[model samples]
Target: MANEQTSRKVAIIGTGVIGNGWITRFLANGFDVVAFDPADGAETRARQSIDHAWESVEQLGLHEDASRDRLTFVSSLEEAVLDADLIQENVPERTELKQNVLAEIDQFAKPTAIIGSSTSGIKPTELQEKMKYPERFVVAHPFNPVYLLPLVEIVGGEETTKEFEQQAYAFYESASMKPMIIENEIEGFVADRLMEALWREALHLVNDGIATTEEVDKAITYGAGLRWAQMGPFMTFHLAGGQEGMRHMLKQFGPALKLPWTKLEAPELTEELQERVIAGCETHAGDRSVAELERQRNEFLVKLIDLVEDYWP
Candidate 1:
C-alpha cells in the first residue's frame, strides 16, 4: 500500500494522555490532525502537552512539513472523522463507553478510513462488536510516550480484513513506528501480558513486605531492564545459553518453570500496601515533578532508540 492523499489526515477522538500522544506523533510525522474532545479546556491542554513534547520529537527528527499549526480542534466527533483517513479512539478504558464511542466513530468515519483503538487489554473483537464497519477496526495498542517509543502492537479481530490490516501496517510504518502485526486476537495482546505478569509479581513482593517499591524499581533499572532495552527476554536468554543458545537454556532451566518462584495472580490492593507503594515511590522521586521525570525519560529514550537501531538484529 502506498501513502495517498487520504492518509495524510488523521482524527483523534479523545484528547487524554494517549490521545495527545497520538496527536503529537501524527503531527510530528507531518500529518494533518483533526482532534475532537468535549471536555472543557481540552484543546488548550492538548496544545500545551504537544508544546511540552515538541522538543523531544524535534530531537528524534521531524518530517519536513511537520508543524504544530497543522492540528485543528473540531467541535464534534463527526466533524473530526469526516475527512480523516485514520481515526484513532483513545477514550477511557470502560468497555461500554469504548463500544459507544467506536460505534459513533464507525458511523461517522469514511468507509475507507481505518479506525484504531488504544486499548491496552480489550480484545479487538470485543471492541469492534458494536461497529457497523468492524472489518476496518484494529487494536493499535501503544506504550506511554508513544512519540518516542517505536513499538505498536497491531491486532485484528475475526471480522477484520487482511487488506485493511496491511494498510494499517503501512500507515503506522509511515509514521516512523515499528508496528508488529499479531496474528491472533487476545486480551492484553503480547507486551502487556508480559508486563502484567511482572506487575503481579512486583505487587506480591510489596504485599508480602519482601521489598519496597524503590527496591523493585532498582532491580529492574540496573538489571533485566538494561538487557531488555536492547534484546528482549528470548534473545537475552539465548546469549545466556552460550553457544548452545535457547535449546540448551530451555533444557537446563525447564524444570524451574514448575517452581513456586512467581505468582500468577495479583495481590490484594489493601490500603497499607497501596500507601507503602505510593510512599516509597514519592520518597524515591523526591522533588522531581512528573513533568521533570518525563523530560529525563524522553532524553534517555532518544539516545536509547539510536543505540537500539545500531544494534538491532
Candidate 2:
C-alpha cells in the first residue's frame, strides 16, 4: 500500500543535474520520489547529489525533518515509474531520444499519471505526439536548482485537456511552486524566449569585445537583477514611470528601440568561444568548487527570499 501521507509518488527518469534537483524538490515537498537513470553508478551519484542538495535545503530552512527519508532511488526505469502519480522526465534534450523514451514509459504508466517534461525549449506538442496517451503529457519546466526556485512553467500540448492542465497547475502549487500556465504550446515557452533574446544580445556584446563575462554579470547582478529579485520587469518599469505607468515609459524610451540591435541568432559554440567563456568563469569563480558555489548561491537566494517575505508582509 502507498503511503497516504505522501502527497504524490513522483518518478524522475534521469538522475543528471536536473533529475537530482527534481528529486530534492519533490522530497522536500513531501513527495515520495523514485529516481531512475541508465548511466553507470548513477544511483550513487544521484544519492550524493541529493544529499548535498538536502544539506543546503536544511541550512536554508527549506526542507522538513523527515525529507531525507522520503526520497528513494530505483535502478530500473520501470520500477521508478511503477505506481507513480507524476513522472518527471529529465532526460537529455534530443527529439528522437525523447520520443523513444516516452513511448517506452507510456506502456507502463497508469492512465491517470501525468508525465511532465523538464525540457527548457522543446514544445510539449512535439513530445506528446509520440506518447500513447498524449493528453497525459505536458511540460512542467523548472529552472536550475529546482529545490530553491519556485517558478514552474506549465504548458499544455495540443492533445492536453484543460482538466489535466488544471490538475498539473494545482499539483505544482500544492508542492509550493508558483506555476504559470501557458495558453498555447509555443517553441521555447515563455521564460526561455526572454532568456534567448537577452542571451543573443549578450553574446553579440561579448563577441564584439564590448564587455567581458564578469562585466556583463556585474551589469545585471548589481543593477537590474536586484530589482528583478523583488519584482518582475513590467512591474519594475511601472514603478519607474511613477503615476504615469508603463505607457509613459513606453512613450519616453520606445524610440530607442529602433536603434541598430542585435540579430536574434544563436552563435555557434566554437571552441575558441567555449574556452574563453569557461576560462572567464573559472577566473570569476576563483577557489570555489562547483558544490561550494551552489551552496553560496542557495544561501544568498534564501536571504533574499526572507528579506522579501518580511518586507512585503
Candidate 3:
C-alpha cells in the first residue's frame, strides 16, 4: 500500500469545474487526492464529478488497477495542503483572491511541495508575490476535461527556479501529460489566445449574419476541425502542398495574404447578442442536461484519443 502511495499526492484548493477536473485527472493517474472547497455541497459535487470523470477514464482504458480508495475531502485548505507533494489551485480567477489563498496555504505546506495554479490569465508572478516561498510556485494550466486532454502549459514565475519548473514538467509527464514550458508570461498563454482569436471572428461572423451558430459548428466540426485534431493548421497546410511542403504552399498562397483578413476584433457583449448566443447554444445542445452532455463529450474524447494513438503511433 505504501509503494502504491508513492506515485504522488495532490491537493486541490477549490472544487469548482476546473478543480473537479483536476481531481479527476490526478486520481485517474493513480495520485492520492485531497481537496478543500468552501462552497456549499462542494465536496459532494466534486465527488460526483470525479466519479463521472473516472468512468470516462476507465472507458478510455487508463489506469485500470488504481482503485478510488486514495481520495479524501477536507473542509479546510490547510488540511488539504499540509502533506501534499503538489498543491494544484483552481480558485476563482481573481488576483487578490488567489493571493490571499496562496499566502495561507504557504504557511502549512511542506517546503519542498510544488504549487501550481490553474489560472488561465493571471501570471504566476502575480500569484507568487503573496507566497512566503515563491520559488515553489508556478502556473500549470490545463485544458478543460483535463483527464482526457494531455497538454499542460508550465509557466514559471518571478522567483520560480528552473529546477522547480523542470520538476513540474516531469510530474506532468509522469501523469502522461504533454507539458509545454512557457518561455514567458502572457495573457491567456498560447492555446487560449489562438482560441480567442477564432472566437472573436466567430462572433463577428454571427453578428454580421454571415452564418448561424449551428452553421459555424458544422463548418469546423465537419471540416477544418477534423484535420486540426490530427495536425495543426500549419502542418495541415504543409501537407496540402503535396511534395512542395510549407514553403511552396506559403509562396503560392502568399499573394492572397494581401486580401482583407479577419479584423480580429472582439464583439461587444450586448444584451441582445448575449441572449442570442445563449439561445443558440441551447438550441444546439437541445435538452441534454450538463451531465448528459459531459458523458457524450467524454465518450467522443475517448474515441478521438484512441484513433489518434493508433494512427499516430
Candidate 4:
C-alpha cells in the first residue's frame, strides 16, 4: 500500500473551509495540489489561507520540498481531478450533491486514485452509492485546521475493500497524520457523535439558563478536555476504578447512564436562543480576530500533539 511516487498529486474538489484545510496539509507534505471551487476569488483566498497557515505548519515541521508554489487552483471540478492520483472532496453535505459530485469525480479521477470525502456525518454507503468504482472510496474525515491536527478517522462503506482502507491510511500517513480506521460503518462515526452529544447538552444548558458559555468552555478545557487529549474515556474510567479496573468501574458509575441529568435532544434554535449563543461566543472571543484565534489554536494543538506522542509512544 506504499505510494511509489516521490510527490503525489492531490485534487481538492470543493474549496470551502475544509477543502482549503486539506490543501494546506497536502502542500505542507510536498504534494502538488489542484483545487477547484466555483466561488469568485477562490484561488487568491486559498493562497492567502496557505500563507497564513504555513508558518504554523512549518513550526510543526514541514516536508523538505513543501511550498505554496506546489498548489494550482483550477477552473472546474473536471480540471481539478483529471490527472490527480488522490482526490479529497469537500463540497456541501447534502446527500444528492455529494453523490453527484462523487460520481463526477469517479469519472474524471484516474482509476487508481482513491477518493475520500471530508464529510462530518454523511455515510460512505450513501456517498458511494452512485459511484462506478465504490471500492476506491472511503471517508477521510479530519478535524478543522487539518494541517495542525493529527487525527483523521477513516471509515469505509460496504463495498470498500480492506486493501483500499490500508491504502487510504497510508495516503494520510504520508502527511504524518494519525489515521484511525473505523472497523464498522456507524452513523456519525465516533468523535462526531461524542461532540454532537456534548453540543446538544451544552445547548440545553444555555437554553435553560443553567450555565453560561464560559462555564461550558471551562467545564471542558479545564476538565475532561485535558484528560481526553492523551487518554480516552474508557481508559480514564479504568484508572478511576482505582486498581479494580474497568469491570469494577462499570459497576460503579454505569447506573448514572440512566439518570435524567442530561438531555440529548437539541433545543429549539429560536432567534432569542441564537442571539444568546452568538453573544456568549463573541464575549468569549473578545478582541481576538478569527485569524488570530486560528493561529493560537494551531500553535497549541501542535504542542499538545507532540506531548501526546511522548506519553503514548
- Listed per candidate, the RMSD to the true structure in angstroms reads 12.1, 12.3, 12.2, 12.2
- Model 2 residue runs over 4 Å out of place are 1-6, 62-65, 261-313
lDDT of 4 at 213: 91
Best by lDDT: 1
lDDT string for model 1 (1-313, tens) is: 1234446999999999999999999999999999999999999999999999999999988888799999999999999999999999999999999999999999989999999999998989999999999999999998889888989999999989999999999899888889999998877899998898899899999999999999998888656776676556654554455455544555676566667778763455455754554455445556765455545655766787666566643
Residues 201-225 of candidate 4 have per-residue lDDT tens digits of 9998999999999899878875677
**Residue 63 displacement in candidate 4 (angstroms):** 0.9
- Per-residue lDDT of candidate 2, residues 247-304 (tens digit): 4555565555555655653455455754554455455545765455555546766788
The stretch of ten residues in a row with the least summed lDDT in candidate 3 is 238-247
lDDT score, candidate 2? 0.76
What TM-score goes with each of the models?
0.82, 0.80, 0.81, 0.81
- How does each model score on lDDT? 0.85, 0.76, 0.80, 0.82
Question: What's the residue-level lDDT of 76 in candidate 4?
Answer: 84
TM-score of 3: 0.81
Candidate 3 per-residue lDDT over residues 257-288, each given as its tens digit: 55656764345545575455445444554565
Return whichever of 2 and 3 wins on TM-score: 3
- Model 3 lDDT at residue 186: 95
Comparing 2 and 3 on lDDT, the stronger one: 3
